[model samples]
Target: MASRSTLLKLTFVVAMVLAVVVLPPPADAAISCSQVLGYLRPCIGYVTGSVPGKVPPAVCCTGIKSLNSAAKVTPDRQAVCRCLKQLANGFGSGPVNRAGAVPGKCGVNIPFKISLSTDCSKVR
Candidate 1:
């Protein structure tokens, strides 16, 4: 049987694909890609396995919680969704599963999955 961490990792990978399918947003995006990336960068080490642990670091959780709080409305949420989708596109499966596990590990509940077929249009 798979370890708990492995199971969680697989679940997140599927969610990441939900984000993967986010279409390009309008020119007047509520959130910028830069902003989304900034909030997420701190978690990269944990998600990518550079950090040696199953739990995400405090800084990583803080960023995820902050991002969760920051995107208050549908437009902002969708903007974030799109940005996340863009992020997943550049990474391979290993990182995606790792990244997927971060939000849950940090105690944040994402409103939607982040997989390629997630249909960001329905994120709200």
Candidate 2:
């Protein structure tokens, strides 16, 4: 006894529900690449050896610490790793890809290596 319009509306609703349930979740649902890059910007100069310093500056360390804290989950860590790899690739053959030392010098421990060869899929 349902009217045609009522049945169409019901079908639409059901289809929407099915789509929501069937679709895979977003890859970086928890973390964003922009966020990962934003947190590491302060350390870029020090990390790339473009700036003269025996150690990373306090601001650089602070940024690294914040990045480390934000990447607590596996997905977030993987996102960070991916972002670092992307940045490294953009840097060409320059030494700007020396991000691995920043974390250690800054005393912040990241869950994954920042090297270009680091397998982000295995970050967990």
Candidate 3:
């Protein structure tokens, strides 16, 4: 017969193996920037000033609202702010200024300014 200590060690090892195999992997704690961008893509025309009207469409506001809702945590909010800054850089100053104004125009209360100069790391 196995010694008590030996049996205990074997039981611990089996339990650990079982836990690894049976338990699901932990879910990601933060949302990806790509996902946030996907939601905001529809607002590009309005944000860029490419569209004739200054007013953003209802769909654009919906997307902004959805993005606002998803970025609940500090990390997620920071990620979103970084992504927006990147997008602003890609859009150039003219469009970026307009883009920054989009949230307020749509009545969406964003935590950080969506400007190219925004320091995303400092976003709360």
Instruction: Estimate, for each residue in 60-105, the C-alpha lDDT of model 2 and write its tens digit.
Output: 8898899888788898888778888888887754554456777888
Identify the candidate with maximal lDDT: 3
Q: Against the hidden true structure, what lDDT does model 2 obtain?
A: 0.81
Candidate with the greatest TM-score versus the true structure: 3
Mind giving the per-residue lDDT tens digits that candidate 3 earns over 89-114? 77778888888888898899999987
Winner on TM-score (1 vs 2) = 1
Q: Where is model 3 poorest over a 10-residue stretch in terms of lDDT?
A: 27-36
lDDT of 1: 0.83
Estimate, for each residue in 40-112, the C-alpha lDDT of model 1 and write its tens digit.
8898888778888979999999999999998878888888888888888888878777787788888899887
User: What's the lDDT for all of these models?
Assistant: 0.83, 0.81, 0.85
Clashing pairs in 2: none
TM-score pick, better of 2 and 3: 3
- Cα deviation of 49, candidate 2, in Å: 2.6
**CA error at residue 9 for candidate 1, angstroms:** 66
Q: Which candidate would rank higher by lDDT, 1 or 2?
A: 1
